[model samples]
Target: NLNGNDLAATVGRVQLAKLESIIAGRRRVAARIARGLADCDGLDIGHEPEGAESVYWFLRIAVAEGAFSLSKVEIAAAVSAEGIPVNPTYRHLPAEAEWFRERKVFPPSDYPWGLPDYAGDRDAVYPCDNAVAAVESHFILSIHESWSDADVDDAVAALRKVADAYRA
Candidate 1:
């Protein structure tokens, strides 16, 4: 029942025609940023796995504990001050969502969570150490296909400046 209208279809076709070039531009920007930031200690600019290619929609950088004097928030703030857009990956964990905490995902009843076959306890507090660490340590940077080489360079420089300034 959900389908594109004539105008949407036309737009979709136009976008599809340029999708390859868009993806190539994104990949180029991401690769350049990655290479630029690769030498920064304590910062983890993710890598593409071998044999796989990614049209990176955004870049996620993880700050390792004890490697920097600044927290993730501090680092993100510093980068943002330099006019680079950055934000925490997740403000809160998935298990901490209101729907999950209230067990109201299906309304009237906790259908999925309370299902007899479900092993997870609706009331149980999940111990997500890794998830917590990631949420606390990771920041996201928006990358766009429209970004120029200078834009990529500026982002890299801002991040490096912050990291170097606060290296523990």
Candidate 2:
């Protein structure tokens, strides 16, 4: 049955990329960003450099699909997913995209996908992913940023340390 005047074609089902798996990763990115901002260490963005190395992409999925945001519980999931500890929440705001946005920031899309380096190269005022890349790539973070990283593995160890401490 044709809804409009169109040529006949073979019948087939539409296929979508497994964005869910990629979406899951975004949660981790969000948590990581939130934690980094909340963390007192003051580590610069791009801790994982190339993008979410130690973090679990699925963490983002949980928050995106679940009730609470990336809280301590979500972080625990990230830890467990990453083979760390088994907690139910994140250290800081796991999927608290709004908070970050208020501060002119944004959260990752959740995983299987990947987080963008939003902050350009101007250095963050309070620690954040590359806003330039983040906004340009997704808009999870804000726009008035001067941070950027071709890769996000700049400082993973420190982020791991923060991710480890979270117990919820």
- Please tell me which predicted candidate would have the highest lDDT against the true structure: 1
RMSD of each: 3.3, 19.6
Candidate 2 local lDDT, residue 75: 42
For residues 1-168, what per-residue lDDT tens digits would candidate 2 score against the true structure?
Answer: 456333332221111244454444454454555454454332223234465353333222122222223453444344345433233422343234544434433334432223365445333244445543232221112211112221112223333554446522
> Compared with the true structure, what per-residue lDDT tens digits does model 1 show for residues 48-160?
56998888788878888888887788888988998998886655676778887788889999989889899875678767887777677789898999999998999999989
Best candidate, TM-score: 1
Candidate 1 segments whose C-alpha is farther than 4 A from its true place:
1-17, 47-52, 91-93, 113-126
TM-score versus the correct structure, for each prediction: 0.77, 0.20
Ten contiguous residues minimizing lDDT sum, candidate 2 = 138-147
